[model samples]
Target chain A: QKEVEQDPGPLSVPEGAIVSLNCTYSNSAFQYFMWYRQYSRKGPELLMYTYSSGNKEDGRFTAQVDKSSKYISLFIRDSQPSDSATYLCAMTHLRGGFKTIFGAGTRLFVKA
Target chain B: EPEVTQTPSHQVTQMGQEVILRCVPISNHLYFYWYRQILGQKVEFLVSFYNNEISEKSEIFDDQFSVERPDGSNFTLKIRSTKLEDSAMYFCASTLSQGPPLHFGNGTRLTVT
Candidate 1:
């Protein structure tokens, strides 16, 4: 199994819809979880970050981590076309340094 | 907000040629990383540098690939001989502290033909 797995979603939704993207990991050692948004041909941009297990909210985006279940999720509320992008879930263990593991991003489309 | 900057937004090189991709990470960041994503594939970590030395690297980062921090400001990745399969988007990233979320540069699109 891959260390981190995310659905390669070409999930389409209308503007103002709630979008929930999720990823599951087989490694319980992962402590730092992050969500990044990438536009076509552009680099991934950090959207939300959380440590261990808990929920973090920032404006229209929320990140949730369930360490016990080895699951993580990013929730987008009232989505906009601007939110159309690939969402990547990344995790890393706090060992020697910060060597990270990434998932195949889920592509999202917020249509107008 | 301070951001990482990369040079030569796009590059095209012939097979067996050497190419150097450059990046300028956030000045105060301590950890630097190199990652690449082949079209339609997941992003893969290449190497990480800290304290002026290579802290860790993946199996994909072989002798043919080398990273250097020549000065306080610039981090570069040099491919000894580019291959057609080496064509991909290379992203440079940095973190303020170890185990923190990494901030990425715009990336350099490298096309090896």
Candidate 2:
């Protein structure tokens, strides 16, 4: 099984709509979860980060992790055209060193 | 806001030719990594460098691939003999510490024909 799995959705949503992106992992040892946004031909940019099994909010972005279910999610509120990008979920174990696993990004298109 | 920077935003090379992708990571960051994303595929971790040594690497980082922190500020990934499958967007990233959010460069899009 892949360590991390995510739906590669070309999800289309109207501007101002809420967006939810998710990923699931099979590794029970993962402790750090992150969300990265990548624009076409650009590198991945860190959008949100969360440690352990809790929720962390920053501005319109919120990241949540559930260690029990090995799931993580990113919620974008009041989405804008600027939010139209590929969202990738990443996770790593606290003691796994520098090897972080990334998911196949979900392509989101926020229509203006 | 300091950010990682990569050179040669795009590269095209013939199979069997050597290629080197360069990066200048955030000055204060200590950990650096190399990742690649093939077209329509997920981003995959290639290797990590710390303290001027390779801390970890994935299976994809084979003998044909190597990394070097030649200087205090510059890090690079060198592929001895490139293959068509080597075509992808190579990204350089760095973090202040373990478990910290990684700051990535704009990436070098490599096309091996």
All candidates: DockQ = 0.78, 0.78
Question: B112 in model 2: Cα distance from truth in Å?
Answer: 0.7
- After superposing the true interface residues, what Cα RMSD does each candidate give? 1.1, 1.2
Name every residue pair that clashes in candidate 1. none
Give the alpha carbon lDDT tens digit for every residue of A6-35 in model 1: 999899999999999999999888889999
CAPRI-wise, candidate 1 is medium
- Angstrom error of the Cα, residue A84, model 2: value is 0.5
Could you give me the TM-score of model 1 versus the true structure? 0.98
lDDT of each: 0.94, 0.93
Residue-by-residue lDDT tens digits, candidate 2, B1-113: 99899999999999999999999999999999999999999999999988988888999999999999999999999999999999999999999997769899999999999
User: Which ranges in model 2 have alpha carbons more than 4 Å from their true place?
Assistant: none
The per-candidate TM-score of the B chain, in the order shown, comes to 0.98, 0.98
Question: Weakest 10 consecutive residues, lDDT, candidate 2 chain A?
Answer: A91-100
- Tell me how far the alpha carbon of residue A33 in candidate 2 is from the true structure, in angstroms, after superposition: 0.1
Listed in order, each prediction's TM-score against the native is 0.98, 0.97
Q: Lowest-lDDT window of 10 residues in candidate 1 chain A?
A: A93-102
- Residues A8-67 of candidate 2 have per-residue lDDT tens digits of 999999999999999999989887788999999999998878878999999999889989
